[model samples]
Every structure is written in C-alpha cells, then in structure tokens.
Target: MTAKQDAQLTGVPSAAMTSLLPGPLVDDAWLAEHLDDPRLVVLDATALLPSPRHDGDHRSASGRPGWAERHLPGSRHADLTSDFSDPGAPCHFAVPTPEALSAALARLGVGEGSEVVAYDTGGGIWAARLWWMLRAISVPAAVLDGGLAAWQAAGRPLASGDTHPEPAVTPAVPVLRPRLWSGIEAVAAISRGEHPGVLVCALPPGGYDGSAPTRYSRRGHIPGSRSLPGRGLLDDTGRLLPRAELAARVGAVLGTADSPVVLYCGGGISAAGTALALTVLGRRDVSVYDGSLEEWSGDPARPLETGG
Candidate 1:
C-alpha cells in the first residue's frame, strides 16, 4: 500500500504528521515525551462499560473500578455517562450543563486554555467524545491518535497510579458552540428538504443500518440522514488521520465546511465526536441533533430511513 493509504488504514503516522484541523493529535511516543508537561493534560474518555455494545469498552463502567485497572499516566477519566454528560436526561448522555462541566473540568485540571489530549481503547470513537466536550465547553483539546492500544503496541511504558491529578480552579464558562440542535418539532419541519440540511448518523454503518443497535428507542436513523461514522476519521492505530486527509474524507461526504450539517447517533455521544471532527476540519456551520434518532425514530409522525 502507498504511504498515504497505509496511514489511513492504520491511523498511525511517522514523526511528521500535519492536519488542516487547527489542533493536532499526539501519538504514544509524543505523549510519553510530554507526560510530565504540566501545560499538557491527558484524559482517558474510554466508554462507560456495561453500556450497549455500541459504546464499546475502553474502560469498565463500574465507576473508579475501571480507571484503577490501567490508564495513561497522570490521566483522569471523563465518564461519558456521568462527568461531562447529563445522566438524568432522556437523550442518554446529553451534554451536561456548562456549570456542571466547568466543575468537571476543574477536577480534571482542565481550566480555560488548557491543551488537553484524550484517547480511548477504540479509535477516535470514544476519545472524540471528550474532544467534542472540551470544544463544547470552549476548552482546546484533541484526541490522542492510536489511543492506549497503540501506545502498548509501540512498546511504550505504562503507569499505574492510585493518585489523581489535582483539580484546577473553575474557569469561565466554555464558549464552544455548534449548529443549533433541533428538537423533534424542528426535525419534523426541516426533513422536507426545504432547509438544505444534512442529518448525519455519527455511528458506524451497522448502527445506522439497524444492524447494530445501541441504547436508543429505535434501531433506524433519522429520516433522510446519511451515515458518516465518526469512527472513520481514525486509522488502525486509533489516532486521527492527518488533517488534510480528514478534511477531504469528511468534506466530500458532507459537502464542505460551509454546508449545513446535523450530526446524531444513538442518543448523542457519538454524534458529538463527528461534530468535533467537522469543527476541526473548519466546518463552522455544524450542529448536533441533540434529540437524535433516540427521540425521532419511535414517533409515528417522524420518519425513519434504514440502510447501511
């Protein structure tokens, strides 16, 4: 395979990697070099386990039990089912309140302007959630390319620590914003194609096709939505592809940064990952379908499109 093709397949890059996305994702070697850099904070956004299979298992869902098992040195857990998301919400893991998120950040030593890196066992799928959350809160962060598995494969050293990173002082609320999320009513009105919209199923082809279901009310996707699978942005190493390549892949499928994109997945976690990728690709007009298929698919009046 050609060098570029190999990079796409494995999601790993040699020393020199560049991206059109504003921020850059670090690999295991790079991360190891800066593990002690106070300016850089690392996080593990592994999926909350015991969840539906779609969430995957980067870490166990048994709370701190999973984190204690093993993680990047000095890294803290960003529980998708708890920390940055609202557990009481109907959308499964909807974005948490900015106030709650700020607190979570303080605990993670992620104050305003902190450069953060996140990773999960899978490719960027779970790690991207944290990346998106930081963006949503206006914190500058990126996912570690190739995740922990990649780090281990490279024969990198691992650290097991019982001590947690001290929290940072709460900073101002994050300024992260995405295209306005439409509710069920808005979705119903917009699906007629009058708005020139793009509804993206952030899950893999299987999830979008109803072949692999998550904790959603229904198995299908929003009517007329396209499958872009946030997971596609990652290479075999579980790291993000170079920015230029990612832009080409994501832009070609969704049009361009200027195109109106609405992203969603089982609940909204995975969709956030896709939205973050678009934002990194310089797409400013993207929004997350917060209610997503979870809210739209079961309604008799709403439409459901099924295909891989």
Candidate 2:
C-alpha cells in the first residue's frame, strides 16, 4: 500500500500532528480548518454553579459572559448547574446518569457518531469533566487541546448572538463499559494501601498537604499517595507538554497499565483531568478515585497524610 493508504489503514493520520496533542483531540488550527466539517459539535462548558461563588465567576451562573462577548463560531454552551450535573450526587460535578446525560446531549445537538469537542477558559478542569462524562456514555468525544485561550490566540473567527441548536435525534441508550470509576470504598482501600497502587494528587501543594482545601470541607489526600500536581503536566503556554516530556514526568509516578493508578483532587474534578492525560498517554487501565479526598477525609476513620 502507498504510505498514505498504509497510514490510514493503520488508523494513523497521514500528516504529522501540528501540535503535540493527539489527532483525535484537535488544537486551535485543526479546529479552525475543520470549522465547516459538519461532523464537529463544539460545546462551551464555562460556568460556575449558582452558589455563593456564582457571581464571582466570569460566567455569572447563567451564561458565560466571555462566550457571549465572543466564542467559537459554532460552539454551544453547556450549563454546569442545569445541563451536565447530578443534583442528587453529594459531590460537585458528579456524573449524571446515562438517561439524564443522553437527554442533555440531545438538547445540545449531539447524537451518535458526533465528533464532540468540549472546552473551558481556565485550566481544562471543566472541559475534562464533560469529556469523561461523554466517554462514560460511550460517545466519541474529546476536549479542545488548550481551550478558548488557545483558540483566540490562533486568530480563529468568533460569533455573536445565541445560537440555538436543533434538537438531536436521541439514539438508543449507549452500551457503556462500566470502567474508570472508583467509589468511596475503593478510595478507602487505597488509603490503607490495601491494593498497593499509585495515587495522584492533582491539587496545589498546600491543598495536597493536611491544610483544608478551600473548595472541600476536608483537606489532605489518601495515605501513601504521591503529590504530583496536575499543573506539572501543562507547559509554559498553558498547553499540555510534549508526549515525551509527559511520559518522562508521569513515568515515575505512573507505571504500566496493569499497575493500577488511582487519581484524585479536592473533589475529583482535577482528577478527571489527570485521567484524560493518562488516556492520551495510552494508559487504558487507569481510573479516577471519584470520591477523592472529599469522601475519604470525611470519615474520621480514614488516616490523613500530609506533605509531598
């Protein structure tokens, strides 16, 4: 076969990736080039919940004012409180059930086989959470490599006016593989180092220590866990570093796929970001400690260990 045909047959794209990001996850340029691809569905997940901190957030709890000011020409907003959240779940940004998630995606004009790209302005925390939700539902999706900042830096076109997408034809409930999830019980076991695994602390140094994180009621991480701040994975430009650098940095903390790697942050949001990084690095067996330190430290029985 010709080189191009060979590459395509092998599931690798013909050209070298312009950015360090994987082909499945596009950068600003790639997204700009494919703006009219018809297959792309971009979602803007850029709002804080309607809590005391809501108004302080740029999105103002209802809509992302920044997105209103300017956004990717075809992007639709994903309301955190209304669209992609589980009201019943005790934790913040918990994964909604399949039915709830399916309905939410349908409203956002996402359907089966849609190439969904999610983004947030800040570090990829919000975008990564939604991307994990999509994967949980068996939808083909990914996050924008560096989010809105990168997009605007590349001089991409922006549009005004609220673009309401037509409702999608809801497909059958996807047959999801119940993996990549760890509950409080599993986190407890990790705290005791019962299973003997790697625990990633994606929080700031102070939060990773015994000091209570501002976001969570309790602070500190599971016993025997290592403090590998999620920011270490990002570059000076706020983009994920090159794969080789990421591999090197993560190699010490993360072993083989067979070796279980449990990740957690204040309330499991940043952990999802780490999980996505691990996924891009081709570690398939990784799972997020969903309850994270929030649930683990809630109980007095669980021992808390501070310091890196």
TM-score of 1: 0.79
Stretches of candidate 1 off by over 4 Å are: 1-24, 49-64, 176-186, 242-248, 255-257
In candidate 2, which residue ranges exceed 4 Å CA deviation? 1-24, 49-63, 255-258
Best by TM-score: 2
| Candidate 1 displacement at residue 191 in angstroms | 1.8
Per-prediction TM-score, please?
A: 0.79, 0.84
The residue-by-residue lDDT of candidate 2 on 55-122, one tens digit each, is 11212254466677778887888876666878798765667778888888878877765667888876
Error of 1 at 196 (Å): 2.9
Would you give me the overall lDDT of model 1? 0.67
Cα lDDT over the full model 2:
0.69
Residue 102 accuracy (lDDT) in model 1: 74
Tens digit per residue, CA lDDT, model 1, 114-162: 6688887755667776676665555656677778888888888667765
Say which candidate scores most in lDDT.
2
Worst 10 residues of 1 by lDDT: 5-14
